[model samples]
Target chain A: MDDYRELKPEDLVEDPAFRAWVYHGTGAEAWNEWVNEHPDHAQAADLARNILASVRGELDSFPGSEVKNRVQRILESLDAGRSGTHPADRSANHRDRRLWWQAAAAGLVLAAGLGALIYTRLPEAPAEKKSVAFVRAPGTSDQTHLEIVNDSESPRLVNLPDGSSVLLKRASGIRFPRQFAVAKREVELSGEAFFEVKKNPEHPFFVYAGQMVTRVIGTSFTIRSYQSDATAKIRVKTGKVSVWAAETVLTASQEPSTGIQELVLEPNQQAEFSRSDLKFALLENDRPEVAPIPIEQMSFEFRRTAVSDVFEAIRTAYQVDIRYDAGLLRRCSVTASLGDEPLTEKLNMICEVIGATYREKNGKIYIEAGGCE
Target chain B: MRPKLILQEDPVSPLWQLLCSGDKDAFGQITENCYKPLYHYGTKFTDDRELIKDCLQDLFLDIWEKRAHLSGVANPRPYLFQAFRNNLLRRTRRVSRFSEIGAEDELEFSSFSYEAEWIHRETEAGLEQKLQLVMKQLPKRQREALYLRYYENLTYEEIADVMGLRRQAVANYLQYGIQKLRDYWQQVVISLVLLLAS
Candidate 1:
């Protein structure tokens, strides 16, 4: 309005409330008035609001207990301000250095002896520890490496490129490429990652795990597809995503021979699939039917499963291999959460219940029967 | 000097002095004074509570840590609010939580702005609750614009800068909010009149 043009800066100075409203609302109508009357006051008012906001926000959202604890530990370490083993004023003279070498030599000898004794006395079995091998794409950097530490101890934050963040769950490992390609962004995930994807409409992000793939333009979601589980699942926390199984079987008579079947998912929906049988099952807000039957079935009952699967979860979950002394393969059933139990403990527990002993050698666990009938 | 003297100095002068001196107490007092209006600004802009909290918290922490190096904080409130506003925009660049809600996702200001002496004196008892009820009845854009312009004293250009809209758009939203609030109050007054007449 012309009247707004005519308004003087004095008008705003006389009315602080009006000024507050104008500034608060981001209205420029009062700008002319504010500048005309009290140009300095306009800027002054702006600074006051900003400073107040910063301080209030800090006091309001002070770090949570965990973050505070971590910061406190770091600060406490700073107070000591040294490799605490050495005194601050100590000089590394030749004599002192010699004494250190002597002490180190004596300690090494004692430690070697103790280690030898402990090694011989502690173990009854020579078991092969299975290690996970990550097959990364070419040109992947060592800095992009992800590790899942499971000691029932603490949680960790993982840093990622593209400003997209992921909080890795405990005991979960994920491997992603260091530099994301413009055409596609993909990560091989085992365990779980809560992903906050940067929205780029041109380049949609894809998460690959076994036969299932999760495609998203921009969204927040969680995926848990450990090799230990029969079915991999993708859960969306916020935003939309397209989930699909890449390896589905089709007859020759079918027009399209490709094995891809796309399933659109909204928030809170999960897409689950069994890679062996090429069957897909979707679950929402609840656990899907992962396995066909109950765990207590007689004879080895596998529904939509493969016998020659290398990372057979049943073998790990029950802790007993199918081979009975490397001759007869006992068909033992398996179904349960393996999260709480160790691989060795689970096998031992199941073996004892089924009247069998597990023998381990060179890393492979074998089931031996005592002839229960 | 006494705390009273500290308060008596021109607000801008004291704030500038305090910031230069790296006085944490002064920083905290400034924040305590400004938080409500800033919060109102944040809530009005984005309905995502978590995002607002994150942006606001990050903005303040940034200011406190960087206070020693900062220059030209003549009015700390605008700078702080502006910073918060910028943080929100940057954080929401990838895809905002509020984007999906479209126009319907207006910030519902439920909290009480109890610090305003004039509002309290006029409303008497349960003013905060009444304000909240009245706020709930406001149109999404109107409430948002009102909280930012009236509560924060931001220029229309500044609001446009924060909201990533044209200056004219901010002006329109501000006028709309004020008109709606006035209309709502007039309706209340009219209903009371009608009840008395009956």
Candidate 2:
């Protein structure tokens, strides 16, 4: 309606009422009359409208059911919270009772697994269902846990926020905090689940299956602790791993007493901790074909390469820290054909000829030698 | 993030009134009607679907709890828009453990992807591409204004309220935003010149 004599394409685009007039039939007759009278500016007005119209891409059309379901959940949670009947209430009584119930449930599932492998037909779209299980990490008294269960008849895949993937077997469940624990990445496993962990050295991942705790730097492995089975097992598919048994806790203040012997397992190796004796032992993996590929890909074939470069490559490949006297090892150069051997074998093969002795402590590979000279 | 425009801008006056009077059915209707748009709008600011869902849940809960002290708004779209923007700004900042959430919080704006919107539109084959690139190059504030104006079709005052800017500022942002888009031709010219120089 204002004078359109000096309006640039940009000016026309900026004008809301003008854009409305152009696109939404706002003052269409008056704008048409003005455009007919002033022929030169019509193109700019049209261009401005085109750009404005194109600026609005189709918005995402979400299914209404998702919104309704979400609203219903919030309303239900609010109602429960008002009635002091929230299931995830952090009271001591609630926590202890829930813990007892889960523990009993875990035992029942384990027992049931042995009796009936009821692989019921998986529910349609199993990923969409939210788990009702709320688990809290053992050490952190305050944070709530994000628990996921594979209730379907078949395996269900879960992707964690930290890039870890879990293939949870039917009737299996895992629980970790919504955000990982500050000191460590810890999750509790009740049944069988295969974890493909993206390694973060600072946040060492721990999987507490029943009373046995399996620790790793970064690797793919499966842990099994069905309710009927007295032994919890950890099989390392890649990278270095250590496992130790922790005494089961019945009280709140119980710490995982460290006096139990810790056993380190190499690739293609498995460890089982007997729940009765609370002892862990290393054994060869039942399946050797699958574990060798990761080891082969992480091969160290150094031809006329500096020892430091070799160690650097190895360190980067495995996400393990190799603490050698950089000053001492910098001068040393060695050539070796390292194949798809487990981490320990490769270290031993490289160190045997180089006069270096390697030992692992706290998940780090330490190379000790006099000197290259 | 261009939310799918809910074409149903039907007079929501009755629903708003019913909701303000503590009607749960009206609340459900509002959620069903607005959830997609709100979700799509939230996605513009963050790709965290969980965060988006959480913000929406919090937004509806807060409104429901405080429905007792509310005024009746005829067109509830703008009110809901304002509430969503405020709720998302507060929650996202607090989620990041911000010490204090202030006016600067709304500065966490969503960006537009023009390619997603690119239609054959009978323009030159790659004209849409150039336009998209130029649009993305606009300043975030200007883009916010343009989005509110063009996408949400908000008036200058409504945009001012949602963006927490003055009416004048909103006007300036729209002017500058479009000017920036129009400058894409100049950019194309400069690129041609550079190509010739090379």
Candidate 3:
């Protein structure tokens, strides 16, 4: 107690008793009594407490799935060693078990090779083959089905045949028909992509990624479904999107099982589907603080902004490549307040003001004007 | 803000006893309980996630294999930390093979940017970056001591055991670390005031 009278702020910070009292609410009476007796030391004590609490930071943590996966691998490896081996000589048993497992795997591969050979020789069903060919032909065969893979580090823009567009992230790919069917628009996605579907109520758009299917009538949303990830996520930016497990729609003979749940996500809502558990979880708020969706945060309102700047802003927001004569549009400026409209509508308004006509071809937007007199 | 340390009694001692008596479920519980904190602590040494994960696997496997002889140990948290730190350093040394790795190696601390109510008002504006810079400049041993004491909420004795330092030396490191931060903060406050006056 006497020593506390001579201690500085730094000394108080170093004392475990003081820290335990301040941080964990332990030994509160003793510290309060000391502070009341020596009122002058109160300021120093407060300063010391502030200093101790000031450096607030968070350590990066592993996702729960990843942690569980790692723990499971470790536990399984230990179990693999424990069976049919003396506990005292565990190191020797580990090597022997690995060798045994490898031999069993090799035998299975050999058996599968023979089975494949036998099955390929006995296939004879002309009617089934004809139906399969009809289903395989994408959008009446005149329209080629194309798959575009974004191999570069940046997001690659792919224009859909139905005026919709997709910003495919790195190492992602999307497959679509050259012309969408009149009844429905569909695309297969692997990895991650942000889709801006054109509004066409008669033709609903379907995105098949990982184990989940997201159906959107006309809206912008981001879907992240890497093959290696344990969970696939869909975040809605505008409008509503309904998501369901791929089995529910793809499995026609299953009679639509009641266990599979379909989640309808609104703006700023996200749905996460866990592959391991076969479960879907919905996050209602989906605030930007958790993960920022760029398209949602961008502003379309421009006040006397240069035509070229507006194009650049649009290009960045949609991650699409827009080609125009930069020199021609440099002097042209337009003042327009655009809100909630789709990308094409906003472009139409801007082009109308700037006296230029625009067209989309091969996923890129091109503008034509006579030097914008 | 960090979670308050449960200082009343050792939470893992009962689990450790069950593990010693060959309870597989107890081992799983212990691994789940300690995995996150141990993984966070391992990041201070290196940013190689795979390497840290490998060391973690090896540490737990070694503990499981040697559980029969480890029955005498009472406090499992500090003991686990001490073993984990040693295993990580040894693996890091073998991987790098250029510099001699030691306990004095520079420890990395994640920068502070998240907002909290407890952050003092005097050091609120533009102080997060400055605090990060000051923390980076501190000696590696002092930084490690401060992390174990404040963030992890370990007692001085526990920190000493984990860091392989004497109890008094642990106290000295904490005192020096806090003193450095206080001095740096005061300078920041004075400069801010001068800027406002001008």
Candidate 4:
């Protein structure tokens, strides 16, 4: 008990009896008495208790029947092994067979890569020719379309004709018209891409990815729709977007649509469209076990934050390089909520507040300012 | 000075001894008691249920074969965990080498929503989400150390033995992990205050 007199919260968290008391009410009276005696340590003790309880709350366990079944299988195998059958020899054999098959598959993949490399060495063909080929819709064949495919290792920025922009991930492709239609703007996407749609209330933006269509007036969101994946997902970053199944949209095109199962997603909400059942499931960002929301969706809210720190936050969240003199901006501070505006608008607002000017060159933002007043 | 509570000795020690002395029923009892916790812990490593099941079977079978040599083991739970973790990692590495799977040895906690009633009202709204984010971003070794300390309830020395680190290193990992959570909590409180003020 005396040893606990000078213990920090961390030390108390590691104490077994203290943990037992917090977890199961074991020796609660003694711990309560100790806390009463040492008023100064009570806060530390309470903090430690909270930490331990929260951690314990995160634990997950399997069902008792499942445990029993697994144990039964193991004991049965042991019983068989005791009766002159060698489980060790059998498992070793199984491992050898698996290793052999894996080695064969690796060799085949290596051969294919070597063949592709040899073919690429010839100068007649363009490098992007071997990448994804864009397929034009039958009815829209007369309309000129532009396609951008990102086959490189880094994200590629595509500036749409309407001032909207997309940061396309590796192995992704986006196809849009040369000029927007008078009624709306539309794009076709494959794989994953983060989109920042330009605000046009009269002409809503539509994204057709896999078996789903996402309609947004002016917002940023991410859509992941791989050809090989079982489900396509759209996560809203800012504002609201309505998602509908492609079949529903097609049917609505023929007639007035009513009672349509359209899912409206807000910031931090996501909708997953399963290809098998053609159903949409809504999810919140609170579930950490699910695939994380892209960094672009991270919200930014600064309350009297340093101007330099604000730029740093944007730089990291957008994965873009920003050149600025941190020492000059150290004295400049701003209080504003961000994350709903586009990258340029965010920069514009921040620079306006700090009396700074910024220029974009070669995909980087450079800020110039004489020290703040 | 306050009185110290009398802690009970490890209850699994006698069962472990009996298993070592060629008692099959004792081995069964150990398996039944340990399989669920071990399975839950294995989930922190990988999501492949088949792979985890295979490794667990291999672990228990190996233990039965080498019971004579394991009699000197004082703590059975941590000892089993160490062995099982090593086996799972070795198998995953072997599989990933040929398959090109991401075999980074990181622990992933199972996702479960915090019960709102259980959380303190002041910090209840978004604390769980922030905690999850912080937990995800923690270094792999620190997360494992914290898991062993809080989830498995292992002492620093036992955790050190399991992780093959010095006892002080385990202590440092727990301190750093807990401090990160505390810092995030403070930030959340401050942000809430600012939100209310505005």
Candidate 5:
């Protein structure tokens, strides 16, 4: 520490260490010890101390509530700029991610490959979300519905109280009770989400997305019901899924009107509902062309392999089931190297060789043939 | 008197994850939670509420647009502060708007004012007044560095980040700023004492 014995009041404040001592209440040991050890410099040290003390004071800042209101407006506008839907290509990419949403939700841990697309499914209605009410007494509510939204580019992992997990997509949201009720594990969703639900026969898992409600005993599936989307969809990756249009609730007094439809979906099946018509259809999922299959599993090189064996290999590679009787195909064999061909083309060639016909039913491919007599 | 509730600064919180993950509500909470501190910092530049608001709005929109690319950070408060400062400076530079009102630098940060709820002693009120005047006369960058250090309670490194200066530069600013305040206070006191004696 420099001797303050000769240093003036102005010179004292110029030292970074002295200023640190004054403001931060630190770096004063050497200076104070030096002053105490030498009484002659006490007067000058005292004068320097007085100058530093008088210069410090409190500064008033803007009111919190006013700035908070202004900032809220800014954030809302930011949300609208990016998530109020996007250009056609971007929307399609987000829309297509719906398939992966199911597979990923099924606890498969699939790759969220198309993460760059700005996926937005705005609710048609300007929701008077009770965000403020929730904030006002966050501590008071014992079972308040906890809402979570993945507004990021990639999927976010959400652990549910019931031991299930959700892989929420970007610009998507889910609201669930803080604790799953004993009766049911109910959660509401907006936009797109994939769920990997815990199996509890005593309590069924339910997801309410827009005008559609999906119930599962225990399984993984994806739901797409962006408020602004013209069509709402539900795709099952595994296990049985039961879905019903929420029109029944909207058209009160009409018990199960013809307008209300319920559909059951199995693995590799998708249910699409049009908002304008209030009607839904079950369709076989289009083959996941973009699904990342392992390089080694990409080729179908079967040499004198049983027809059943061929189907088994396809199932392992594509995660799609091909239903066929092993008994009828006991004598059937095939020798062909199918490389990079479309799934349908490969299936066609195999079915022709085995003298069997194939048809898609509920996302499953079924094969039938008169026993090889 | 400053309201404690309004002046509350957020600790490093989960708000960062929520914001980076594209949660609109998280964005809303952040605005409501950190706006006062941010506004307090912005007004140090200029008191025009509208301009500050506009700049803040633009900053937030930019954050949301690039949410996908943003790193999942734990504490983004400093980053927000830096962004607000940069935006305000950039906008003010374009028109030299606030400076036209006073002879202060175009990007002048508002120095400590005496009318504020000062915590100085009754005996040192006059000294405080003189100190305030000295503060106003300090260079803009020095004033900013002092504000970030003593006022915001930011570390030397954090102040450097906000001011876009090296840590050494920030240390020098504080040193020079305090020195100037002490010198001016002495001069004003000596002149006052002499006038009284006459």
Candidate 6:
């Protein structure tokens, strides 16, 4: 602290950027170091304090709605640029799925050899069974027709057949086969819907949303053909989906650039077709989408998956949160294959079984694990 | 004045996850949500709406592109404000761009009636006015860094991602920026204090 006392007034006058420099450049450690060393530099510290106060005042004045709206707009523009109409990599989706299945089978066989007892215990409590649950809101009945009509609300979700689900954002309704179409699975949706399709190579799932039709062999995808919005969009998560608007198909297409476009999506590559512009744009590809590969075959793993990361993944995948003390996240690790589990079930299983504390806060489930007890 | 509706909290927020996944939604959400603040931040530097919009758009896009590789983020809001600042710096760096604009030229812009709606008493209003004057002298990048870091409260990593620099570089920029501000403002404060005493 004495170091700052000896500093000349000129030293403070000459440097204005030190506040942010010490705070960000050297982390809390260096910032504290500077404050301790220069305790008597009251003028310097006061200036920094004033500037921070003003900035905080401004930010505090900023409305949260502005933040949400800004984020939405940026997403929309980027979505416009990197839509589905970009060039299609027809074979990439198929190639990856085949590779995953093969790897999973091989890993399982190897694991069985090493631990016979573990292999024998596997079927006792089925992982997939636990993952699957009836995620019904205060409903009419389990057998009654489940309809989520988002007339007043933004969007609602519904589970479709073949172990997949659909989130119908506001003003959307989807009807699926009671038990899934035997040969060709189909769903009729009027509005925006995100689909996580179950892989059934023998039975292709088809979505008849609007003037557009999306067909998938087996993949995870999100479709936003919201009835109100002019544009219809689709982003593939895993496997491949073939999408065709009114007149075009990616395969054996007739009219080139001018006509309505078609696209086949690879994992992480999105395909969006807007009816207004009647064109498409493909976004730059991201790293890769992680789907349900065999647990034994897991290679890309987070050493100790940060609780924050887990919370984010769950929220994104299911649009829910297991809220907890933000500070407690530093000590938590969640190791699990993020398969096709609904958001609530995953959180419930993770928090409840672990003896962690969790409850709904403003419609979000917050969980506290390590330090809670 | 800012819209009252802007303060309401969204319940089922998925945008944070989208940011983590480097999804395009994250970018879109920022553009939609932060347009007003970014626009205003730009206006603080230059009243040119088109320029502000352009800078913000590019900044948001770049943030989206680099999201996957972005590390050490506890939040995204501050990161975005930082991005807005960096974009302003890159654009303003072309000396000719600044030389062309005149202070007298009035640009028709959207009134932040939302801000005006909040009636401030005399002393608070005076402080705000003084603060604005202090902010005006800050170098473009430093102003941005300070705004995003302290105002929006972004982490160093987020600032680095937005500014296209390493963590240390962001620290240097911010530190240097803050140091300058402190010295510059001290004279203003001293004069005011002495005048009051006299």
How large a fraction of the reference contact set does each model reproduce?
0.02, 0.23, 0.23, 0.32, 0.18, 0.25
Per-model TM against the reference? 0.27, 0.37, 0.46, 0.41, 0.35, 0.29
Query: If both were scored by TM-score, which would come out higher, candidate 3 or candidate 4?
Result: 3
lDDT ranking from best candidate downward: 4, 3, 2, 5, 6, 1
lDDT values of the candidates? 0.45, 0.58, 0.64, 0.65, 0.57, 0.48
List the candidates ranked by DockQ, beginning with the highest.
Answer: 4, 2, 6, 3, 5, 1
Compared with the real two-chain complex, what DockQ does model 1 have?
A: 0.02
Q: Write the per-residue lDDT of candidate 1 for residues B1-198, one digit (tens) a residue.
A: 000111123354466568557775566556555554565466545545555544555565566667777756665655676688667656665334435643323333323221121122323355446754665555554544455565445678766665667989887776555454444333333332233233
Please give, for residues A1-373, the per-residue lDDT of candidate 1 as tens digits: 3333433333332244433332222222344344346533433333233222211111121112323342333333334543441223323231111111111112222222222222233344133311121211111234433333321223333444555655555445555556665565656554555666777788777765544667888776677665445566776656788876532111001111134566777766777766444355777545323331111111233342322231255443232344543223334433332222224444565565545677766446666665433
lDDT of 3 by residue, A1-373 (tens): 3444565767676666666755434554465557557666654575565455443233442445556776787788788874422223324223211111111112122212222222223345232211111111112222245667665667776768876767777656676777775567877776677888888888988886644777889888888876445688888878899887643111111111244577888988888887544478986557642344366566678898988888888888777779999887788897987644567777888889988899988878899876666
Q: Each candidate's interface RMSD, rounded to one decimal?
A: 26.4, 18.6, 20.9, 17.0, 21.3, 22.2
In model 6, what lDDT does residue B160 have? 74
Please tell me which model should have the higher lDDT, number 1 or number 3.
3
Best by TM-score: 3
DockQ of each: 0.02, 0.11, 0.10, 0.14, 0.08, 0.11
Candidate 5 per-residue C-alpha lDDT over B60-169 given as tens digits, one digit per residue, 9 for 90 to 100: 77877777777665458778889888888787776475446642454666534331212122114676575556555677777677666654567788888888899999
Report the lDDT tens digits of candidate 2 across residue range A219-277. Answer: 77778776445577777766777776543311111123335577777766777777656
Q: Candidate 1: lDDT of A41?
A: 45
Which candidate number has the best lDDT? 4
Which 10-residue span in candidate 1 chain B carries the lowest summed lDDT?
B1-10
lDDT of 5 by residue, A1-373 (tens): 4553466665554445555544433433454455447655443444454344333322232334445556656755654665542222323222211111111121100001001000111223124321111111112222344667665655665668765767666566776778876667777676777666777788987786644678888876778776545678877766788887643211111112344577788876888876545568876654432222232224578899977788887666444568888887888988887653345656778888888888878658898986564
Clashing pairs in 2: A59-B3, A59-B4, A110-A227, A110-A228, A111-A228
Candidate 4 stretches greater than 4 Å from native? A1-8, A21-46, A53-57, A82-373, B1-6, B97-100, B105-137, B193-198
Model 5 stretches astray by more than 4 angstroms: A1-61, A82-373, B1-10, B72-75, B97-104, B115-137, B183-198
Off by over 4 Å in 2: A1-46, A53-61, A72-373, B1-10, B72-75, B98-107, B114-137, B185-198
- Predictions in order: chain A TM-score: 0.37, 0.40, 0.55, 0.55, 0.40, 0.40
Candidate 4 lDDT over A1-373, as tens digits, reads 4655686767777677776665444565576567658767754664565455445433333445567787888888887884542333334323211111111112222222222333334456455543222221111222355667776767777768787768887667777778876667878777788888878899998887644778899998888876445688887778899987643211112111244368889887877887545679986553322344355646678899988788888776666789988888789998887665667777878988898899989989899998786
Q: Name the runs in model 1 displaced over 4 angstroms.
A: A1-373, B1-13, B45-53, B89-142, B154-173
